[model samples]
Target: MVELDSRVETRDGVALVELVVRNPTDTARRFRVGNLLDGPLWPPRSRGVPEAGWDDGGFEGVVPAEERRALGYASPLSGGARSDSLPEPPAEIVWTERAGETEAGNDASFAAEATPEGVVRSLGDHRPPADAVPTPRSGDTVSTPESGRSEPDPRRSP
Candidate 1:
């Protein structure tokens, strides 16, 4: 399982509600993020985590072991809505193990060990600048390039 935390910032004009997931698993596996039941809807331009379910409403992706990943969606500001209402992402998250993957029974606990300010500052260093293009580390899909988007994996991305 991965521990998660939420943070929001206005990049340009979009209200980017970002979630940082801490993967403590030893092997690479995919994780799922439930929908924002209380906050604004996720926009199309919003990147980071992969969409899950047949309808692509939720998020699914691979997080490398002992690494931090920023996965989130963005929403354009609405006239009637206030950005203050944005919900802080939950600290608890679940990492779904595939059929062949080992299941580390949820015997351990996940906690937000770092300060919020420290986490925010660290995220800035992981991602690349807006104008940069990502280079592929795997065959087809392009992972997060210079940005702290995603950690590198020798195997295919889920």
Candidate 2:
């Protein structure tokens, strides 16, 4: 079984989220995920971030060949562009599988929390610093591909 845990922290008004992906397999694998938090509590509507499935990297996340990677910084939650309903943490994740040694998409077990001030209330202006931008991998210029979702195991409790 795989484990998926999500942590949400509000710093300087920006919602910083970290998704931890763990694979129990002997070898490392790749996983794709998006809308990891797209559900009722975290409605598609946003006052902070672009729609989960929008231009924001498709399924918008990738768990690298490492056994465990915290995927954040790349996707930060924003207070809705027009409203105060800040975005909630993604509640789910789907890892990708290639043909050869690829592993099937395992359901990510999920968990979430917010700072006292970041508890799904109204938000303030908290854009990232212009210099905090992420660097591309070596010479890769394109964004990571959007991921397809698979049947998440029964543990969907948030």
Candidate 3:
């Protein structure tokens, strides 16, 4: 099951909203926290690409299994105006599913693999360390300061 708790506060001419979404089930759940109040939603951060939940008339993100995630947004009040009525059940659940169970699950190549580390690491992360010096490959001419000469790298078998 999913649980939602929301609080709204008006401060400095803006209405600040804080929401806590909880997932108490064994499966992870996806939810949408709608903007039931007046004005456009401004996520926690405004710069760069827009956050996950702001574009769809609300905030949308995943709450992991047996875990909760906090989401918040702010809306500017018009001339310090106030609303006498508030929306009931400020947030609603869109859907929930087992973690990593996607439509692509039917494909063997796209299946998700759980690791002992409890985190998925990308396959393209094999690049050398950021600070590591570039090594000359086979057939590349390298200049050596010790010998003061240019020659094929000794590290490679000719």
lDDT of 3 by residue, 11-101 (tens): 7778787888888887776666678766767765322334433554776566777888887778776664774344544445555555554
Ranking by lDDT: 3, 1, 2
lDDT of 1 by residue, 46-120 (tens): 124222221134565556677776766766665555666655552235446542344332211123225443344
Candidate 2 residue lDDT tens string, 1-158: 34677776655544555667776655545545555432212323344543332334334333334366555533344444321344554445555542135432332212222442333223543666545765444434333335343433222211
In angstroms, give how far residue 149 of model 3 lies from its true place. Answer: 63
lDDT of 3: 0.61
Preferred candidate (TM-score higher): 1 or 3: 3
Off by over 4 Å in 2: 36-55, 58-66, 74-91, 98-158
Model 1 vs. true fold: TM: 0.44
TM-scores, each model vs. reference: 0.44, 0.37, 0.54
What's the C-alpha lDDT at position 36 in model 3?
72
**Top TM-score hit:** 3
